[model samples]
Target chain A: MALLSIADALKSAIAEEMRRDPLVFCLGEDVDIPGGMGGAFTVTKGLGEEFGYERVLNTPISEIMLAGVCVGSAMMGMRPVADLQYGDFLFCMMDQLVNQAAKMCYMSGGKVHVPMVMRAPCGASNRGAQHAQSLEGFFTHVPGLKVICPSTAYDAKGLMKQAIRDDNPVLVFEHKLLYGGKRKEKDAISTIGEVPEEDYTIEFGKAAVRREGKDITIVANLLMNYKALEAAQILEQEGISCEVIDPRTLVPFDYETVVNSLKKTGRLMIVHEDNYNCGWGAQLGSWIAENQIFLLDAPIVRVATYDTPIPFSPVLENYVIPSKERIVEEARKLMKV
Target chain B: MSKLPEKERMLGMYRQMYLIRKYEERIYYLFLEGIMPGTIHQSTGQEACAVGMLYDLRKDDYMASTHRPAGHDLAKGVTLTSMMCEMFGKEDGCCRGKGGAMHTGDMEVGALVANAIVGGNMPISAGVALAFKMMKKDNVIVCFFGDGATNEGAFHESLNAAAIWKLPVIYVCENNLYSATTSIALTCNKPNPAADRAIAYDIPAEVVDGNDVLKVNEAATRAIARARTGEGPTVIELKTYRHGGHSRNDACQYRPKEEEKAWFDRDPVKNFRSYLLSQKLVAEEELQTIEKSIESDVDQAVEYAQNAPFPQIESALTDVYWEGK
Candidate 1:
């Protein structure tokens, strides 16, 4: 086992996939340069040196072309892992991602498959509204696309490998705060984890029980998963047992695990950095209410960021995004209910 | 004057153009009779542009088409029966009844599923070309779009990327003069938008009379050769006109009568046939036989589509993702 950061884990995953299959390649802005930060966060750093420029392609700052290239290449039997400098830039290529890549298989009557992975670095950093939004909610809503958010180095490496091998378009939303790169965020959490050296893949729709308990089940992902764990620790001190569930993949959601956890805890709460209205948590809450309403002893609670765009100011940003205190408070409220 | 292709190749182009013309005519009549289920963006008059550009492409060479894709798909060798079945929304369709008229294509024949979004295929074609280039393959991709697509950001981005990477792609703009009723004059300020813009990307560009199959074929030959030799992309603007309206119900009242009449006078299929006869490359009896055969083929396709079954209701739930190999 080697201790790797999220960025290194993703890099290792891509490198291994490229070595395994000649059809696998990567494209993005600043993806490969002699002295550049391999992509914005260095996930693809040093890959060009090993694989040459043909595999690690550096493209112009064109998100539309980046996404279009992935869709087109993937359709032609080439596995392309496209990267966006920021998750918010995915909006620029919405036509390619949502309309083309997502619908190509369905539109082609399953004859064509876009086996590609789009990596978007998400979460609220110091960057203003345009750059700092956790946009997983928007992509999770899109059909014909698989969405995965990896919080740990282990999950990032495994899920990325699975994404590359999968014969469908998968969007991997990596939290900027959890990348654990050289350029650290002010509030970045400790995301270093021991990743196995051997080839391994984590299947989608499997939620990990980070801290199992009996009082309340708090379902979260990305950076919020760590926050939920922090809240669980705090609640443990107060004699309130809380179980934290990290749903690795959002589209193929592990509702079974959440339901099983709710069966044990008898209460459920979802925490996410995405905005409150129509966020992924909203779907999870609604699903639990519709299917497992009788199992719930209290109303399903969702702790998420405010609906407004993420602000630049640290104070305003902290106020909007969900924090450990908020998760703890929401979990306490659910316990009271 | 451009050097003409061999008699056999010339006749083949004429045959393909004739097939496209007849196919569109049959589809129009089928829609009129309420036999066809979906609407069509017909390529009634731009048959030569499709045939001349796509006839020489190998089976593995990719072609990204526009909403009006029947001409391109037929020319790219997508079976007429599959296209007709697709039009009928039957299970035996090329897209298995999922893609309607606007999205008709067969990847087996190297036709990427037709893109309905304006200029959506431009970047995709570049990417396909990028793949061929990365694989070190000499195969080229032909991207077909309208004059209006030249103004989209995707077109510029795609062209720039193709130019920089030296990807093997041909950007064929069938300048039908209108973006669904809005004249190209209103949207574009340049006389030849695609050709003129190709200069900005440092790529070679050409303007051809789309009604003249020979001229289109000549230009496509040079462009395809350049792409095959790693000379990067070429933007070819084929000046043509559509005989029918943009969609099923469009009367094309926005077009001027003199303009319409002038374009109709140079109908690609009719003029190409005349060229073939005048050049003595194909005898009148032989041309007539080819036309009759195409008509019978269309008739058989229509019959097959009418008899083919619709997909099961549960099949809609599948194909969202590739199940597996």
Candidate 2:
């Protein structure tokens, strides 16, 4: 085991997969330029040198083309890992992603399939509205896409390998702050952890329990998971035991973990950086209502970003996005109920 | 002038072109008779473009198509029975009756489902070509689209990428003048919509008489050769026309009577048949025999589709994702 950052872990997984499979390749703007940042946050750093530029292909700033190429390649037996510079730019490739890649197999009547991985760095790092949005919620609603967010280094490498090998189009959402590599971005925080050197894979739809308790259950992902853990510590000091869960993948959501925890606590609170309107929290809350309503003793609460664009100013951005205090306060309120 | 290959090759091309012409005519009448469900963007007059572009393509070579895909699909080797069954929404249809008229294709025949969105298949073709390059295969992808697709951002972006990477893609733009009800002139000021823009991406562009199968085939052969040799992508705009309205209910009032008549006079199938006769490539009786066989084949396929059952309701829930090995 080694203390690897999420960026390094993701890079290692890509290298391992590329070495294992000849069909796996990477492409995007600045993905592997010699003197450029290998990807926006260095998730593909040093890969160009290791695998050659053919496999670590560099594309123009055409998001639609990059995404469409990935879909086109995957259907023809090439597994391409596309580096979507920012999660917000996914809109540029919406037609190819939603209408093309998502429906290719079904529309072809199982005659074709797209095996591709799209990695996008998301979360507010003082970048304005367009670059700072958490877009996992948007893709989760799209059928035929597997959306996974790995906050820790361990999960990042494991899930990335699984995503590259999986027979479906997987969207790996990485929080910018969680990428604790050498090319650290401004105002970014580190969430590095020990990662095994040997090859391994973590299955999708499995939730990681950061803190276990018999009190209210708090579920979060990406940056919000760390905030939820922080909130759990604060609430623990206040004699309010809380259970913290990190749902690794939003599409194949680990409702089982939350349900089991909710049976013990009978209370749930969802947290994320995405806005409240039609967010993943809303889906989970509704699912709980339909399937796990009996397990809850109190109404579900969601601590999320306000229904507004992520402003540039730290004061406004912090206020709009959920913080540790916000989660603790929301938990305290839910605890009372 | 590159001589016409073998008599056999010319005859095969003629047969494919005739097949597309007859199949589309059959489909047009089926829609008019209220036998086939859903709307159709029939390729009634664009027979030469499909046959010429796809005649020499190997079964392994891919051909991505637009919403108006019947001609391209048939020319690319999709079975008549499967395509007709697909039109009838039958279980054994190409797309299992899910992807109706606009989305008919069979990946096994190197024709993936046609994209309903304009220019949606351009970038996809580049990707398929990229796979062939990475896999070290000589196979190339022939992407077919319309004049309207040339204006889409996808077209520019994909062309630029394909040029930079020299991806093995032969982009075939069946320039049928009008996009639905609006004329291409209203949308793009350029005389040649697709070929003119190829200069922006540094790709070789050609404008061919789409009504002439020999000219279209010559251009396709050159483009396919360039792609196979890693010379990069080619944008070929074949100037053709649609004999009918854009879809089932279109009255085609948008088109000028003179323009429609002029295009009808140059109908691809009729002109090619005349050329074949003038060149003495085949006797009149032999051509008649081929046409007769095609008419009967289409009739039998229509009967097969009518007897074909609609897929079970539960099947709609499957194939949403393929767990292919």
Tens digit per residue, CA lDDT, model 1, B1-325:
1244588788888889988999999999999999888788999999989998987888989999999999999999999999999999899999999999988888889999999999999999988998898888899999999999989999999999999999999999999999998999998889998999999999999999998887898899999999999989999999999999999999999999999999999988888888878988889999999899989999999999999999998999999889875
Q: Give the CAPRI rating of model 1.
A: high
Model 2, position A250: C-alpha lDDT score: 93
Which ten-residue region of model 1 chain B has the weakest summed lDDT? Answer: B1-10
Global CA lDDT computed for model 1:
0.92
When just chain B is superposed on the true chain B, each candidate scores a TM-score of 0.97, 0.97
How displaced is residue B279 in candidate 2, in Å? 1.8
lDDT of each: 0.92, 0.91
In the range A1-337, model 2's lDDT, one tens digit per residue, is: 9989999999999999999999999998999899888989988978989999999998989988999999999998899999988999999999999999999888878788999999988999888999999988899988888999999999999999999999899999999998997876776668778999999999999999999998889999998998888889899999999889999999788889999999899999999998999889999999999997999889999889999999999999889999999898888888788
Give stretches of model 1 more than 4 Å off.
B1-5
Cα lDDT tens digits, model 2, B1-325, are: 2355667777888899889888988898898899889888899899999998888788989999988999999999999999999999999899999888889999888998999999899999989999999999999999998999988999999999999999999998899999898899999999999999998889999999999998998999999999999999999999999999998889999899999999999988889888888988889999999999999999999999999899999989988777774
Clashing residue pairs in candidate 1 are none
Model 2 stretches with alpha carbons more than 4 Å out: B1-5
